[model samples]
Target: MVTTTGVLFIVAAVVLFFFWIYGIVSFYFDLRYRFLPAVREHLRDDEQQARPDPEEYL
Candidate 1:
């Protein structure tokens, strides 16, 4: 019974680790392919525009 439990725990740990890795990798590729260019463009626009005063937003 103890051996079985240990094996189950190990399997679960490995599966969870793989899932975490997969999520990080997926997010990186998705951002690189889908969102990075838009983000860069927005940043460039912000830099080109005059800096806004923080009080203006309030």
Candidate 2:
């Protein structure tokens, strides 16, 4: 027979597991949709700016 404390512990474990899954999914989507694009754009812009003037470097 399950006691009240056991039931509470099981419930808390289930709740925390659900929250952990939720956080992982949220972070995955956020990084895929928003953060990566912004970073790629910044890197592309920096690469363009870093090219030396043809007259100065050649």
Candidate 3:
């Protein structure tokens, strides 16, 4: 005999597994394609380096 609660649990687990996979893939793509480029551009900017290092104040 199939219990309704057991079926519901299985369905929920499958849905959550898909969500976990989607999160991982999206994060990986965002980091590789978007986040890294932005970071590189920011770091390479001359204006940032021209500013006095905040650590010097310490």
Candidate 4:
């Protein structure tokens, strides 16, 4: 009842679906580990700005 092309297409689709799922999982982890820390650091404003020496301008 099944054709060779149909089986091949089903296998290809399943492999592609798994790859898509893996990509989504990896992207989620990347944001959780790397992006969140960067966002927190950017939000914190406790550091003082550096003042240039007046003699340098003269």
lDDT string, candidate 3, 2-52, tens digits: 999999999999999999999999999999999999989988886788899
**lDDT accuracy of residue 55 in candidate 4:** 80
Rank by lDDT, descending? 2, 3, 1, 4
Task: For candidate 1, write residues 1-58 as lDDT tens digits.
Answer: 5698899999999999999999999999999988999899999998868778788899
Cα TM-score per model: 0.63, 0.76, 0.66, 0.72
Local accuracy of candidate 4 as per-residue lDDT tens digits, 1-58 = 9999999999999999999999999999999999988887766633322555678899
Residue-level lDDT of model 2, residues 1-58, one tens digit each, is 9999999999999999999999999999999999999999999999999998799877
- Candidate 4 lDDT: 0.85
Off by over 4 Å in 4: 46-58
lDDT of each candidate versus the true structure: 0.93, 0.98, 0.95, 0.85
- Flag the better candidate by lDDT, 3 or 4: 3
Model 3 is weakest, by summed lDDT over 10 consecutive residues, at 42-51
Q: After superposition, how far is residue 47 of candidate 2 from its true place, in Å?
A: 1.9
Candidate 1 vs. truth: CA RMSD? Answer: 8.7
Over 4 Å off in model 1, which ranges?
Answer: 41-58
The TM-score of candidate 1 is 0.63
| lDDT of model number 2 | 0.98
Whole-model alpha-carbon lDDT for candidate 1: 0.93
- What's the true lDDT of residue 2 in model 1? 68
